[model samples]
Target: MVNAPSGISGEASLEDRIARKARELGFVACGIASAAEDPVRAERLEQWLGEGHHGSMEWMETRLAHRRSPQGLWAAARSVIALGMSYAPAHDPFALEEVGDHARISVYAQGKDYHDVVKKRLKALARWLVAEQPGAQVKVFVDTAPVMEKPLGEAAGIGWQGKHTNLVSREHGSWLFLGAIYTTLDLAPAEPHRDSCGSCRACLDVCPTDAFPAPYRLDARRCISYLTIEHKGPVPEDLRAGLGNRIYGCDDCLAVCPWNKFASRAAAMQDFLPRPELVAPRLAELLALDDAGFRALFSGSPIKRIGRDRFVRNCLYAAGNSGDAALVGPCEALADDPDPVVADAARWALERLTSAP
Candidate 1:
């Protein structure tokens, strides 16, 4: 454990102590940024929202001011500590797509819910800070918050936000899960990192739905991650065909990044290991899961948040794209699901199956 400098007591400098503690807590990288104006990002976010690119994630619009600048959220906040953990998978995520009958869950969703894992660690770090300096105030945030974590992570030097709009680190590649700790104490800010993705259009070219309108700008409406996780009702018919076998979030952008070749495998956190059934689940079997079965199977996983209806809806699409007539039965069975969205997707899948020669 790294200790504060002699004679400093609670007034010890934050740089060395915090970095050492973050490493001990298993964070791959930690960086600090003073809460300040981000004019460029503010303009970009406003433009993205004006174009209605966020789809049904209305919350993005609700916290526009705070999302663009952290100081807007907490006036007392002096420093934003951005932390990242590696969630790299042992196998290539793209490989699962080749198995026509199986559903492909994004690498991030294959393990335990990252919200829980990252939050626990963030809270621990926050508590440590407060313990070291009595009366210190702090707040922690994961993806649930309205904060623009990607830009903050970038500003903090943890990584650069890639063209796909997710933060990418050279050390961890694009496989990092980000969390933030906002503290009232002033901390030495780290130098922001420069973008290393020069001339690399791999992520842009690989997106099936063409979500990127330009480098670093994403139209989430067309993003599979938004379709499967955020968009509530029927997925736009035009995008369904491009969804391929993905039943949760899409990883084409992240998977195709050349930086990922250097990504480390899953950390020692066993909670991140793929659940036996989730690794390459049969689309037919997944579509057959009832509400109770779905809840039971995804009890500890991030997929549970989508619930059975949306999950089955996603499975229905994958089933349709499987090109295997064997999945027809499950699709047909789900055509009358109690949830209108699920039933509607099932109908669409059935049509695709029947229409196929």
Candidate 2:
């Protein structure tokens, strides 16, 4: 049973009211979990980090204390509110795989940076919650925080962590953007979402680089998304071919999950709708972008955070895999790029493109 907010009770229960408000604010799912520490979640994170699966994201290890639990980050936190906003795509993310001349940005990154969108919604929810129960202190966190959002998401019954190490909703599938609100107000924890990925190897099988060492395990070093976005300098030689035409993030694992069959495009918040230019961007155009051009093109995009150099380097990798000789002229221009990484990627792409049988 949900604890109704103080001096506020009529018909709808507290959980129902919050759920309705979250839905009204564009979140598709909302659930509450106790802010108490979970040894299992903490241990798993320690194990994952110990295994070096985080790649070059050194911040994960640096902020290990706060990441262990909601309370670890904020001492007075008594309840955790988890929310999910749908970003489910209307089209298949893998459709561009055979269309090499075009770049394949991940479905999630094609829209405005989700960090801004989700955080705004989270703050709104927190504001409403505070107003409902005066003096109930709150702090909100999206992906930027060291919080264990997925585990909190699971604990709050938002979704279960799937084999791909991403939270999967039966309703939204792998297409939800998650955020959390830690409040000093105590609320009953929702029943945890049970694992439902049973007997399905689709997410693992679809990985182009075999990034998953086993079910429910990911080696980020071998992950195309990590290599393209997080890793600096040149990509490992063996993994470049696996990148294919994917210039930004990869969606292979998320796209193949059968649970997404239930995902609805209509459920997605308007903020997540793909921009026309990002949908089927050509490699030739992206490969030709200079710093100013890159900044202007991706002004409000998540891609902008990776900066012009990293993004161009990714485009070069895609160009190398494109088999489109027309991109050669653009790649040649970047061969002496100011950034060493971009220049290296250009040379690598040139070799692969010219030497291709």
Candidate 3:
């Protein structure tokens, strides 16, 4: 037999019950936070956007108000359940840094799209909660909406958003996939996660592009993850070399956190297992992909979201940085690609390779 809260009906503590259910659903971390105003987060968001740090992701600016408060986004949402799934790698994500001729994809993109994986589980958890709490309203969200997941995650005790501006879990490390469940059931909130980053500057100093304008803040325009996946046009010439062989997203910051020591010893999820081909793909092979080839190769993967043009555009930059004379042939082949951005990247890559000593 279970006991209910003073007004809500449930046998177990709402927070405990939901957290256990979330773990059963494969989430490594779960906590709840009130769906109320977060003035400091709102102000930080406004300042970040006001400085034009979001780059071409104009949606962030448009959805500013919605992101400030969960209740504002959904008028009836009284509590928020923040969740995190570990995509922790079995080995060091930085180990491939010396592999000049191979494209190093972000560790998170090495497997199935996390958005699909996380959202499916979030929906399952939300459905269970709704069924358990009669007359309660609920909404689920992953990275797709205006939800300020990181701050909410912090408030909910999932983890603190570290110097890299990505959530860091003492137990799960920096490689986490976050999701949220908003409800009107008045669930109990958890103790907020403490800021454990301390004096560690490893994540900040490791950035090849120096993307951080300050501790705990990011300028997305200078972020390689943003440039490869979100920016539509040519990459800035100055930053191209800094990208190294990172063809999709950069994980330099996330990979360097000291908390990752705990993650390597933790259970690794099969859903995040790297596809053999994606582990360290040859730059030459990536550059050879046509649209059809690109789609088929990255199907059911997050890399597909960037589409062929952007994916290949990233490949071109890696090719230029590769310094492998053999890739010049493939680079030249894409110089006349149908997409202007791809063509520009190809020309730039060819120039770099041709001018190599």
Q: Give the winner by TM-score.
A: 2
Model 2: per-residue Cα lDDT at residue 33: 93
lDDT of 3 by residue, 129-158 (tens): 888888888899999999999999999988
Clashes of each: 0, 0, 2
Report the Cα lDDT for residue 129, model 2.
87
Candidate 3: stretches off by over 4 Å: 1-11, 264-266
Regions of model 2 farther than 4 Å from truth: 1-10
Best-first order by TM-score: 2, 3, 1
Provide C-alpha RMSD values for all models, in order. Answer: 2.7, 1.9, 2.7
C-alpha local distance difference test of each model: 0.86, 0.91, 0.88
lDDT by residue (tens digit), candidate 1, 178-279: 899999887778777788899888999999999999999999999999999988899989999999999999888998888887777855356678787888
TM-score for all models, in order of appearance:
0.95, 0.97, 0.96
Give the Cα-based TM-score of candidate 2 against the true structure: 0.97
Clashing pairs in 2: none
